[model samples]
Target: MKKILIFFLFFAVLGSGCAQHNAESIYDKDEDRAGTDINRENDGVRRGNGNQDNGMTMTDQNPNLLNTDNQNRHSFSMDVQKAKDVISDAGYEPGSIWINGGEMNVTARLQGLVTRKDREDAQKILQNRLSKALPRYDVKVNIE
Candidate 1:
């Protein structure tokens, strides 16, 4: 009998708590008292209305963000040509040159059989020359 009474009391309290949450009834009184016009258009943000000069132009943004694919391709090709010239001037046959962002990878082929020290010296010389020529790029030289 005691357990049945406790169970009935718990359910009664829970049911009252759940029934007290009427969202519409709580918000309706505030909405009625505020009395603000719901149909008004401009609410403080500057949206362009055909003739108003807001003074904010798209050209004010960063130039790097506005760079097109054509500009990037031209820049990359120029860098590759520069790398090829540097490799050729260093007395090696330029095989392939690749430029990615600020890094350049260059491959050059030596004509005859060369010793390991000769290859190492050649790589060092090409690396130094490329670094000096293209100071903006981190260069890697491969001799084959």
Candidate 2:
């Protein structure tokens, strides 16, 4: 009876140790994964900054990093086109306008020395036009 009891206790201790080891290994793997993520983030920041030397004008490595060109494609949906017409009618040239059909938000950044009055007028015109064209979406005009 004593031998059997000793054998059971030994097995129980062995099982618990195995469980502890497995838990430690899992914790180590999680730490490794987090470290990798941090390294990747650092690398991205470095890549964005690019290489710079002493006394030289730094050129943009990725000029289109923000994807502005693709986002500002003149060819827009019908709603955005109508909104542009309204701004033009108000005598405010739409320099950079971004429209997301999915988001249903219109963001227009007017480029140039635009007077505050002109901006207000443009906003009024756009609001009217967008209400008529894209009734479901809201338009936000930002002067750049």
Candidate 3:
């Protein structure tokens, strides 16, 4: 019984030591994977500054990062086109459409002679239509 107890204790200590070593190695690997190792100078390899010796940046290494900005611009253009379509459908010539964040500034020209009240009414109607079409944006319409 005593011999068995000693054997079990030895194995327990060995297992604990191995577990600790594995945990430390895992932590080190995680730091390296983050690309910002403080010990980069020791290995003579600088990382995580977006530039590498091969003239490639972090964005270049991951093309998805560039795609994110492109996707945003593409979606914004599509939204602008939709606004233009809405303005045309409302019997106004679509002018400039500016989008800043969640706010949209739209300008449309009214054909034929009109009164101030007519312009105001057209602006309101176009604003309502645009707001309904692009609920994600705060719409402001100018009828000229």
Candidate 4:
């Protein structure tokens, strides 16, 4: 009876430790999986800054769809195309105009150097123009 009790207790302790280890391993795996997601989210911001931090950037991770060359390749909504035309009519060389998820993104070359306030004014003007045209669409402008 004593031997049996000791054996059962030994197994109970061993089994508890194993269970603890199993739980830890599962938690580690979840963390590891989420680790990539966290890094990817940060990467989006870092990369969007045009890799200004001097970090190595991967072109494939983020494509340069803001180029004027590919504008015809992708099918755009009527509002996006209309905004592009408006930008062109405004005498600005538009880079790319894309609309997705009720948002519009515009990249264009504006007058004045990068240091001037005109760049920001240009962005705002373009943003407001699109906003007036597509009231419900979120507009974002980028200068090249």
CA lDDT scores, all candidates in order? 0.77, 0.59, 0.82, 0.69
In the range 1-144, model 4's lDDT, one tens digit per residue, is 999999999999999988875565543442355465332355464222254646523432344433344334333456777887878877788888776766788898966666657777877788788788777778888977
Sorted by TM-score (best first), the order is 3, 1, 4, 2
Query: Comparing candidate 2 with candidate 3, which one achieves the higher lDDT?
Result: 3
Query: TM-scores for all candidates?
Result: 0.51, 0.34, 0.53, 0.43
Candidate 4 off by > 4 Å? 1-76, 111-114
What lDDT tens digits, residue by residue, belong to model 1 across residues 55-123? Answer: 533333432344344333335667788888988888899988987677899999998999999999999
**Which residue pairs overlap in candidate 1's backbone?**
none
Q: Which 10 residues in a row give candidate 4 its minimum summed lDDT?
A: 65-74
Which one is best on lDDT? 3
Can you list the residue pairs that collide in candidate 3? Answer: none
| Best-to-worst ranking by lDDT | 3, 1, 4, 2
- Every model's Cα RMSD, please? 9.2, 15.0, 12.1, 17.3
Q: Write the per-residue lDDT of candidate 3 for residues 40-122, one digit (tens) a residue.
A: 66777865446345865545565344444332344577899999999999888999999888899999998899999999999
Worst lDDT 10-window in candidate 3: 63-72
Residue pairs clashing, model 4: none
Instruction: State the lDDT of candidate 2 residue by residue for 28-136, as single tens digits.
Output: 4423645653323554652323445544322333332343434443334555667677667655665555656533454556767779897787667666776766566
TM-score between candidate 3 and the true structure? 0.53
Best by TM-score: 3
**TM-score of predicted structure 1:** 0.51
* Alpha-carbon lDDT of model 4: 0.69
Model 3 spans with C-alpha error above 4 angstroms: 1-26, 29-74
